[model samples]
Target: QQQVKQSPQSLIVQKGGISIINCAYENTAFDYFPWYQQFPGKGPALLIAIRPDVSEKKEGRFTISFNKSAKQFSLHIMDSQPGDSATYFCAAPYNQGGKLIFGQGTELSVKP
Candidate 1:
């Protein structure tokens, strides 16, 4: 089974600083990469996404940088805040059924 390897199981950042998470995959068949954020009691929500055709994508304070050659991608959180504290996951869609294969997940904490 294809998998996404995520780094830094947890991260701590200042309220106004930046938080970064990285992931790498082995399957070249995967074309879509999406980042999800989950709060304590809520289901995960899509934060941002990028395709192999695009090298980078940004929305509000979230950004996704993709490197097709290396089969890797990363998420950057700008101006990290307490509200941004949550578990983030990176995932790729399965080629056949379109199911998502997710990484282990990274817990982020923004300290004031």
Candidate 2:
């Protein structure tokens, strides 16, 4: 199993709203999980992540809720804001090559 698929292609959330995006994977062997955030014309940056050994992980305004049994994971952005508008991506590596298999892309728009 080595595939991760994400949805919503795009999202729009109002300021102070909660923005949620879901992802599914096929690889059970994957041990590392990471969610990346990117701005226009920029490379993806690590936002948050969780390991298979853990159920969930949170960092600052970002959180990653993982389900090992369901082979699913999600990213949650708390108190959405206009500055939070950007593309989010979920990814996993095949075998620690520093290469990540990413979701198609999700363009998030946070309105003021």
lDDT of every model, 2 decimals:
0.92, 0.85
Best by TM-score: 1
Name every residue pair that clashes in candidate 2: 1-27
Per-residue lDDT of candidate 1, residues 4-111 (tens digit): 899889999999999999999888455899999999999999899998778999999999999988988999999999999999999988676778889999999999
CA RMSD of all predictions: 1.0, 1.6
The count of residue-pair clashes in candidate 2 stands at 1
Give per-residue CA lDDT, model 2, range 1-112, as digits (tens): 4678998899999999999999988874456778888998999988888987778788888888988778888999999989999999998776655777888778999999
TM-score of each: 0.95, 0.91
Relative to the unseen true structure, what is the C-alpha lDDT of residue 36 in candidate 2, on a scale of 0 to 100? 85
Model 1 stretches with alpha carbons more than 4 Å out: none
